[model samples]
Target: MPSQVEVMVKALSRLLGWIYTFCWSASFYPQPIYNLRRRSTKGLAIDFAAINVLGFICYMLYAASFLYSPLIRKQYAARNPISPDPTVRFNDLAFAVHAVILSIIVYSQFWPQIWGFRVSRYQHVSWPVAGLFWGCLLAILILTVVVVTQSPDGGSDPAYWAWIDVLYGLSYEKVLITIVKYCPQAWVNYKRKSTVGWSISQILLDLAGGVLSLAQLIIDASFQDDWSGVTGNPLKFLLGNVTILFDLVFVVQHYILYKSSGDGEDDNKAPDPRTPLLPEEQALQR
Candidate 1:
């Protein structure tokens, strides 16, 4: 029932939503990769690395469900709301293959512990518990895909795919935990009156991403109950809105940190270049 232009706009909207949802790598890859290259782990939390390597599994599975799941269109006026056209079956298969490959990248982050591992032992995970869950999901996912694809019914249920997404979201809980721990360590380092081990750049980018994504989610959620694709998804509305608010805390904290660092720099006394006056200084002056 939706017009051509409307459909295209809505489709584009949804595409952007999906893109932002998987923007985890965009958030993580830059700093971590840079740190690894420079070997300057300063201001980089080891826990973030460990949890991140482990968290990739969750993110990848999430990416899998997202990339593979059928999208129900929100229409202008329709009893059954969806585009009548058949989604490409083969494309799903191919994308699913790529998902499997990405999963390997996720799983490979957790292998035999050797110094060659980019993550330090202090920062690397001792137990890849999150990694294991993602690995299992990946295994089950392949089997599920093969069977479902071969079956009479093409894999088309959003509900079925939602489980993987659920797991994926759940996996981020540990990432939050790791970040929480790292934040305190960050605070402690600065408590001595210097932003000694903090990277304001990282926090700034995080704030920027969080804010924009928050707007995106608000747009998505405002339409959830509408069932009209034009409005967007309501669940996205709730989660995205909440995230925007909570992320503000970090923004404030980082701003305060920036100011404090300036104060610390100013408070540091210059080296005393003046030579000490000897006991005979009074006689010399006379």
Candidate 2:
């Protein structure tokens, strides 16, 4: 039997969890919509989409394994002996699955044949960026093979523990991917001096999600009086904060620095938004 205060706190935590899940999941929609209406992915970074798809896939793996695998849960308990509160919630798993689907949709928009959208010739992901995504995928593939080969038996053997470690490593990989994924988009916005193709709605929703996510973690940890719930899962904590920082960067790029001017609006329908501004055209804007 729980006390009244305990019940209320648990209820509040659940509410926050759902709200942030909705926010983060819904955040994926605006970009595809924006691209559809614009009929172009001119200012959107291909690298951003590529990296985002991979990141969410990793997150899905992490959440699903933790929630479904008793062995993995055992591994978590072994690693973190102190904090015993729930780290991965239903909402977290839901968000991860939703994000992975939406991220794939968004990434598909980058290709001309898939969505039949026009993209500027200049709008291509650099070789290094492509290499980065492939490199990450290869690492995940190799580790997956190791986990499969090493954990043939279901017992709590060393090989089984190694598989658990790989699952846990995916969580950290997601955090790293989140940190890197934003860079290309931010750089694109800076280079173009605009955020015309990028969706600010996505950023706003992501910010809401990130803030609520961090708040929910704090509340749950406090309620359990087990700070290890937050501290032990440092990657999750770091992911929320890192997402918030990049969302802020995008907000500033969209709202503060490169806000649209009526006279020089970046036409969404333009076949090539990457066309360089002539000296006279640049002078007039100044």
Candidate 3:
């Protein structure tokens, strides 16, 4: 039986979780909306979009496996022994699925013919970045095969189950992606000296989401009197903080760094991607 205070605190944590989920999920919208309205993906980094989709797909798999997969959950319990199942919650799962969908939409806008949007000549996923993501995805597939093939007989040795480690590997990969994904966008902004076409709405909402997520984790751990919920899930914590750090960088880049007339564009605007190229440039495009 739980105390009334305990019940109330748990409810509060649930509320916070939902709130952060909304914020984080909503953060995915503005960029695609901005692109749709402008009919262009100018100034947007396709590399960022490309890998963002990949990261969220990994996150979705990790969240879903820990939340729903009996085998993975059993293995997790075997390792933790005392700890409750992995801290992945319904909100986390919801956010990951929602992110995957929205990120794919945003990434599609990078293609001119696919989404009926114009893209800047410079807008492309660099071969190195593309290859890196391909390698990461290939690694994921190979590990899945290994886990499937190496699966042993019933109750032989829980330690031998590779799926648990594979799930954790997915989470760790997400953490790595979160750390690196923003670099391309930030570099693009810096090189252009502008934040145009990179929606600041997403940045502000992402910041809110990241802060609220960390707060919810802290509150949940304090109320439960189990710091393992926090310490055991360092990658989750890192995801929230790293997202906040980069969102702040984008906020600064949009507001203080490139803010001239406060429209999230530079004073001397970069040439529009939708502008008709000169005849020679069009010929080259053909």
Report RMSD (Å) for each prediction in the order shown. Answer: 10.5, 4.3, 5.3
Residues 188-231, candidate 3, lDDT per residue (tens digit)? 89987778778898899999999999988888767657777776
- Stretch of 10 with least lDDT, candidate 3: 260-269
Better of 1 and 2 by TM-score: 2
lDDT of 3 at 108: 89
Select the stronger candidate by TM-score from 1 and 3. 3
**Cα miss at 123, model 2 (Å)?**
2.7
What pairs collide in candidate 2?
Answer: none
Looking at model 2, residue 265 earns an lDDT score of: 24
Candidate 1 lowest-lDDT run of ten: 71-80
Candidates arranged by lDDT, highest first: 3, 2, 1
Deviating ranges (above 4 Å) for candidate 3? 145-156, 265-286
**Model 1 reaches what TM-score against the true structure?**
0.48
Candidate 2 at residue 193, lDDT?
A: 81
* Model 2 C-alpha lDDT per residue in residues 50-117, reported as the tens digit of each score: 88888888888887877888867776677666764347788899999999998899888878999899
lDDT at position 143, candidate 1: 53
Per-model TM against the reference:
0.48, 0.86, 0.86
Query: Against the hidden true structure, what lDDT does model 2 obtain?
Result: 0.80
Rank order (by TM-score, best first): 3, 2, 1
TM-score of 2: 0.86
